[model samples]
Target: MNDALLALTPTLELPSVAREQALKKQTNISDYDFLLGWLYPEDELLPPNLALFSKTTGPVFIDFLGGKKNHRRQFGGGKGQPLARAVGIASDFTPKVIDATAGMGGDAFVFATLGCEVLMIERSPIVAALLQDALNRAHLELQLEAEGKTYRFDDDEHSFLTATISRMQLVNADAADYLNHTKPEADAIYLDPMYPEKKKKAATNKEMTALQGLVGPDIDSSKLLEAAMTVAKKRVAVKRPAKAEPIQLESGKKPSASIQSPNTRYDLYVVASTQS
Candidate 1:
C-alpha cells in the first residue's frame, strides 16, 4: 500500500463467529488494523457498535435495497435518464455495462436496477472492501426479501430487487488491467473518475469529501479510457459534471457523441470494431 493509503487504513471489525469468514475472504486484513465486532448479516451494525466502518466517516455502507434516494432513482425516470440513453438502453438491445471506477457502486446499482447487467471494478482496497461488505449484505437482504421475510415490498418490487441484484457483480481489481485481460466484451464501459476538488470550503458533500480524501482523483483516467475503447463492443460512456470538459484523449481517439442532463453529461466513445 502507498503511504497515503497506509495513513488512512480502515479497521475491519467482525463478530467472533464471522472472524474465520473475514480472514478467508479479506486477505488484506493483515495490512490493516483488525478489530472484533459482529456485523449481523442484516444490513446494519450489531450491538457494541462493531461494524465494517470507516474511522473518518462512520459506518460506510451500500443499501440499494432501500432508502428514498435510491428508491426514487430506481422506480423513477431512470430508464429515460441521460445515462441510460447514453448506453443505448432505449435501443432494441440490452447492454451489459462495466463500471470501471465503481467507487461507491451507486451508478452501477442504478444501471443494474434499470435492467442492465453491470460489472463493477474498484482499485482501492479500502473502498473495495467496503463495497464488498455492502454488496454481501445487500445480497442477503435481497434473498430474505425474496422469501418474504424482510423489507415489506410488494411482489413486483421484491422480484425487481432480486433481478437487479442478480444482474450486478463486483470485483476488486485495477480497471486497466481488468479491461486488458477480460474476455467477454461489454456493451458499454462506464467511467466516473473523481473530479478535482475545488479551492473553496464546502465544495462537496461529506461522503464525496471523505472519498476524495481517501482515494484521491483518478489521475490516469485517460489511460483507463484508452483501455475501455479497446474492449467495449458498442461504446464507452464517461460521466462528468455538466460544465466539465470531456475526458482527454490520445492523438486520434474521440468521443462519438454526448448526452447531457441538467447536472451531468455522458461522453460516448464508439469503438472501431467488435473484435479485440
Candidate 2:
C-alpha cells in the first residue's frame, strides 16, 4: 500500500504491486485488516461484515445491500421498490439500460435486476474502482467472509440465471461523454444525481459522502438529462429528495408518478410507458 493510502490505516501496508492486486480484486486496505474499519468509522469504510454479504442470514444483508446500494433509500416504506419500477425512456422496444450516473452502483444494480442489460458509466475513478471492487469480491469467497457475491442476482434454482447476470459490466467514464458521443444501443437511460437533503435534519449516508469525495459534482447534470431524454426510448428516471422538485424542473416533462418513501422520492419522467 502506498504510504498515503496506509496513512488512512496503518495495517493497510500493501506495496504498490500488491495494492494493485487488491484493487483489482476489490479488496481494500481494510480487507487486509478488518480492524481498520473499526478504528476509522469516519473514513466511511464499512465493517468487514459487508465484505461478503452473500453469506449473511437470508435477505437481511442482501436487503441491506440493496439499501446501501441505493443511498437515497431508507430502511422502511419500500422506497426502492417504486423507484426501481420507474421506466420512462421513450423506447419502441425494451432492452438494456445505461445508468449514466452510477454513483455507487445501487441504481445500476436495480436496473439490472429489472432485467435490463445495464451498462453503468461512473465518472469518478475512485468510486468506479470501489464499485468494481465490491462486485469483483462478491464473485469470490474470502477469508473474512463467506459466499462470494456471484454477481448473478437472479434466484432461479433450476436455471443458471442466478449466475448468468455476471454479464453486466461497469465502465469508468463521464456520463455526459458517453451519452453525447457514443451511439450505443440502449432502451433506457437512468440518472440519480445526488441532491440536497430534503430536510435540514436529513441524515446523509456516509457512503454517499465517500462517493461525493471521489466524484465531484454532476456539473453537467442538465446536459445529462437532455442527452438521456434524446436517447432513451422509454424515459428518464431521476432520483431526487421526494420533496425536491425535478432536477430538470423547468422542462415541460413532469414525472408520470412520484413514489413516496420515508426518505426520498422517485421523480419519474415518462418518455413513454412500458409493460412494468
Candidate 3:
C-alpha cells in the first residue's frame, strides 16, 4: 500500500457491524490518510454505508442503490446518452467495456445499466473498498428482491439494478499493469484520467474532491492509454474536459475522431489492429 493509504483509521462512531466490515476490508489495505468507516442514515431501517471522512470534506462514498445514481439509471437518456454513444452502444451492437480509471464506478454503472458488460479497474484500495461495499450492498438488495422480501427500493428498479450489477465486474489494480499483463479481450476501453483542477472554476463536488486528494492526478495516463490501445479490439475512448486538449501520446498519434458534450469530450482512438 502507498504511504498515504497506510495512514487511514476507522472512525470511532462506526457501529459494531460496520466496524467489523471495515476491519475486514482493512485486512487487504495497508493504510489510508482519512477515516475509513460507515455512515448510518437517520432512518434506522436503512443499512449503513461506507465512507471516507476528512476534516474539510463531507463523507465520500459510492452509492448505487439510491441518490443520483438511481435517478441516472432510471432516466439518463438510455443508450442515447453521451457516454453510451461514445463507447459504441447501439441497437445492433453493445461493446464489452473496460473502464481503466473506474474511480467511483459511476460511469461503469451507466454502461452496465445500458446492457454493456463492464470491467472496472481501480488502483487505489481505499476507493475500491468503497466501491466494493456499495456493490455488496446493492447485491444484497438484489438478493432480497429475488426472495420476494420487502426492500427500500421499488419493484421496477430491481430489474435493471439486478441486470446492471450482474454485468459489472470490479478489479483492484493499476490500469496499465492490468491491461498489459492480463491482455483481457474487450471491444472498448474507456479512460477518464483525472485532469488538473482549474483555478478559476468553482470547487468540484465532495466525491471528486476527496477522490482527487486520495488518488492524486493520473500522471501516467499516457502509458495506460498505450496499453489500452493494444488491448481494445475496436476502439479506446478517453474522456476529457470540454476545453482541455486531448491526451498527448509519445507516438504522436491523434484520435480518429472526437465526440463533444456540453461539459466533456470523448477522444476516440479507433484501433486499426489488436496487435498494436
Candidate 4:
C-alpha cells in the first residue's frame, strides 16, 4: 500500500512513539487502518465523512455526551457558552474561536456557523487526515453548489468550510503539542476532553461510541488550559460536568476570587490578555 498521502499538502507528522501510544489506546480490535483509506475488508464503517456532520446545528449533543462546547454564543456560534462564561467570556458572541482539539470537529462546526474564523487543530494522523478529507470534500461541494465561493482544503488557496463559516483553518497537529507553540490570539479557546461520562448518560450515541473507539480518552486534557491561557486573546473556556469542581481551581491554583454563574458551577478562566 502506498503511504503516499492522498492530499495536496504536507501531512502532519507525529512522534513515532506518541503515534504508537495513541494508536494503542484505540479500543478497536482493528486499528484505524481505515483512516489510510484502506478498504475495510469487513462490514464496518470507513472514516466518517464531513457531510454527515456538515448538517448538524443548534446545541451540540455530541459535547453533552463527551462534555465540552467549542463555540459559545459569546463567540457568535453557540446556543450557550461553556462553563468559563461566568468569569467573563460573556454571551454576546465575541469573535473567533480556536478549537485546540477537533476530536470529531463537532464543536468546530458549531463555531463555523456563528461566522467565527475557527482554527481547528487535531493531532491524530488518521483523524486529522480524515478531517482534512471531509473538509476538502464538503468545502468543494459547497463551493461548487454555489457561485464564486470557495474555502481552502487539500492545501488549496481557499476553503469552502472556511467560507461557509466566514473563515476557518484546519491544521493537522497534536492539540497539546501544537497549542504549546502556537500564538494566534483568538477571542476564545474551547477545550473538552473525553471525560468519564456521568453514569446517568454513559450510553453514548452511535457516533460517539465510534469516536471512543478511535481517539480514546483525552488523557492529557488537563494541560490544555495552561496553553490556552497563553494564547487566547479573550478567555480559556472549559466545559465540565455541572457537578464537578473546576479543574485547576479545585486543586487551589486559581485564586479564591470567583466570577458569576457560580450556581451553574462550570468555571471559565479569564487569561489577562483578553481583558485588554
Output the number of the lDDT-best candidate. 3
Tell me the lDDT of model 1 at 88: 75
**Across residues 53-92, which tens digit of lDDT does each residue of candidate 1 receive?**
3334433445666665366665668678787888878757
Q: State the C-alpha lDDT per candidate.
A: 0.70, 0.52, 0.81, 0.52
Alpha-carbon runs more than 4 Å astray in model 1:
1-56, 201-203, 274-276
User: Best to worst by lDDT, what's the order?
Assistant: 3, 1, 2, 4
Inter-residue clash pairs, candidate 1: 14-37, 15-37
Summed backbone clashes in each candidate are 2, 15, 6, 11
Per-model RMSD to reference? 7.3, 9.7, 6.2, 9.6
Specify the poorest-scoring 10-residue window by lDDT in model 3: 8-17
Candidate 4 regions with alpha-carbon error over 4 angstroms = 1-93, 147-162, 197-201, 249-251, 255-266, 273-276
> How many angstroms is residue 270 displaced in model 3 relative to the true structure, after the best TM-score fit?
0.2
Q: TM-scores of the models, in the given order?
A: 0.78, 0.60, 0.85, 0.61
Question: Per-residue lDDT for 185-215 in model 4, tens only?
Answer: 6877877667754547645665565555556
Residue 25, model 4: Cα distance from true site in angstroms? 24
